[model samples]
Target: MSTTPTPTPIPTPTPTPSLTLTRPAPTDNPTKPLIILCDGTWCGRETNTRSNIYKLAELFGVRIGARIQSPDGVLYLEGVGLGSSFLDYIFNGITGQDIAQQCITIYEYLVHNYTYPTHEIWLFGLSRGAYLARAVAGMINNCGIVHPLRIAGTNEIDAPQTRLLCETVYNLYRSPYATNAPHAPQSLRFRQTKSWPLIGDEDPADRTAPRFHPPIRFMGLLDTVGSLGMPEYTGGVGLDWPVFYDQHVSTVVANVHHAVSLHDRLFVFQPCLVSRDHARHCRRDWERFGVTRQEWLPGCHYDLGRQRFRFLREFGGGWLESLLASRWFGFASKVIEPNHVLADLALRWMLLAIRAQSTTVNYEVVANIERVIEDVTESIRGRAREPGRTGDGDVYGHVLSYAPFGSLLLDVVRTLRGTRGKVSALYQLFFDLRDRLIPDDNAVVYDFYGFDEDIPGCVGDLARVSERRYPSKSYVKWRLRQ
Candidate 1:
């Protein structure tokens, strides 16, 4: 069953934000939307993994404090990074329990301090943080927010004991060991542990700890590696992934954005359980609207987050990781100079292709990306044993540019317009095959988000080959091979 759809609090009567005022707000206005950022393992508040989150916080925090209305209409943003200290990594990073615990803080803030119906919530995270965001969304949709036993006052932070209760609430919704916990039937824990549609004369309007809730506005992620922090010996809490599934959450979110790395190979990082299950559930939600989308780009898990949080590794690096493995391994090192260090193992660790609709950017320029990937991958496979594959051959550089894609799109549309009702299996078959590699419609599309100008020099280049999308899909379609 799907998670219960919690309507976002959009007050019917919106008070005009004093757009002309330049002083600190007298009282926090209900119209303000709260934006929260959760960081990945070992990279929370102190070492925020994504730079964009930090920038957004700094930029918006000032505007809100100064009583100036932001163009985006956001007035508040919360940034939390899990496993910020060394001890936390040693203790809780593996299971990503610390982050789950941290999400309790978000729960309290929304439940007690910002419960107004007008408040909207936006969540952004990277890697482990993304998993936490997904789990939180599912929890909110299914069990609803839990009111704090004791929220900190206007000037104070939550007490340690109160924070613990928040974690207990999240655990009840998603942690591996929450359901069977023994608690008094009258206690908050007892109510929270129960599933959706609370019993008795029930409705969200009922004032209670577990039933108090908030609506989500958006959730955006970057390469959600849910089990990355789990210890390898345990093979991780694999079955527990059902706890973070987003199917039940489809109705609660207005948008879901995911950016993944096509070449990250840490071995420890595993794809989110939700991504594996999307085809059966969330895919339909996405095709009908811009509600769910994930764009795949070249790089590793960390690199995708870097596209927004930090800098790209080579040519133009905005993000920095001290680990040599994260910095120069695999396809990333080939940005400027081809990396022969582990060239033989390139495709062995490739991530699957992605699908998403394009907005605020043009996809026409990248129409031939599929053919380019195929051509380059084949070349690398043929020369896997060469001693210095990255040197002069420049084998991985340059995609075959098949002329301007805009014109090609127009030609396809014109061809299809005339054959609407009649059965054109030949055209349909060709399109079906070609679409697998490159989609003609927005049903599934790949995107390079916020990565236009700073493409790293090591990633190679593109060369225009023909004025066509593909060489008829027959030249290399051993499956559809001419």
Candidate 2:
């Protein structure tokens, strides 16, 4: 019997978001594919949280302290980052600074840490992470990724040669402004970080000039909310937040997969909204490659995203929440509010509630949540149809996931309208009622994700988002660009 070839060793790490070097998967094939997954804001790489990115990583058998049996030749590595914590997410989550950092960090980690002469590269992400993945693809397609060893004059920091070279690299990958944006189509920033006359986008096969550009096989994203310079969930805009997410798409990537959420409506959450205009631009970019698939799924932001933290994982799904998921509005409307005492009370109360529940999830309770949904959906629609309502084109259809509970909860505080407490009550009551609901077998399961195969929290392929949902009459918010 022939012996197995030795796995390739990774180079020294200079600065990476997070690098994982492991033995090749248990397979005889020669080509080992590297799959890098990025998590969204507040998506912890640690074991405590339930990030879909991690779930995908686990599927690839790329873990911190475990060996996995993967299909064929596969070596998994993930580049994770968004902000420091769930708090930084409140402000810096989608800033250009953060996106740029993630893009560069991931690129450096991959290009420097590993050399995949014969392996495939796949980029996967959700929410802001998706934006970064697409941005990375754009950079590679335009301003190719360079190896760390290729960064010249590292020994002499003050040298002009070193300064210019470092600035070029930094501006290309991490700068908020790209003065050469006109030449670079992937990123549309007009000041800096833009492409400067085929500087990095040289021929791929060429061995000279610190170059190694791997063709990304696929880009899979879930509800890519490239909010561009939207204000923070808590308050204020990022100093480095790019004014525009821009009209750039990587021309090199082979295929694109985007899972769109039809029902995500929370004001602060709305800024990250991926518009139909952006979708059209993406399609145009991927047109030559002929690999663009976009789908619309039901549920609120959490239903679409499935970002479960410690509190949700232990408690599981509720009438309003699947895996205790809530959008930025949940905290932005509460804990981050200017009120000092109330925020503390809310935090303590939430901790108490989470502590009260056992880690064991109750499926029966989740199954019965449909009753609550039906009640709330019908109730909200009835109120909206009262007078001068767009019966056929109500916003509810677009935000089916969150509108019901959000509307009903709003009714509870209609008496005390405009106060922070009123808004808090709306959000608070929704979660409270969700956790308390019991099962109702009489309720037929509603198909939120239009697929026959049930991938809970939707940790699956974007192509699986379904073809039937494409021509939906409900009018998902993706308007074609003029």
Q: Which lDDT tens digits does candidate 2 get at residues 1-482? A: 99999999986444321111111111222144556676665465331344445555654555544333434333332223332343343346434336655665666545543343444456777667777777666555545444333235554223444334433554664445554442455443322232222222443354343322335655667656654443332333212233434334444454565655444444333323222223324333234333455454433344344553222211122333322334533531211111111111112222222222212222111123344334323432233223421111112222322332445544655545456643554433222211111122222222434432322222112222222322232222222211
* Poorly placed runs, candidate 1 (over 4 Å): 1-30, 44-50, 62-97, 148-165, 175-214, 228-248, 273-290, 307-482
Q: What TM-score should be assigned to candidate 1?
A: 0.46
After TM-score superposition, the amount by which residue 361's alpha carbon in candidate 1 deviates from its true location, in angstroms, is 22
Model 2 residue 34 CA deviation in Å: 2.6
Q: Please report, in order, the local distance difference test score of every candidate based on alpha carbons.
A: 0.40, 0.40
- Candidate 1 per-residue lDDT over residues 1-482, each given as its tens digit: 78998999975543332111211212322244565665555442333332333333443342433232434433223222231343343346446655555566566555554443455566766667777677667656544554445444664445676566666666655544434322223333454543222212133353332311225655666567664233332123322222334533444455576665444433345555333223334344334433555554444343344322211122111233223115443322222222321221222112112112222222221234455445435553455345644322211112111112334544765577468443343233212222112121222222212222322112322211121311222112222321
Q: What TM-score does candidate 2 get on C-alpha atoms? A: 0.46
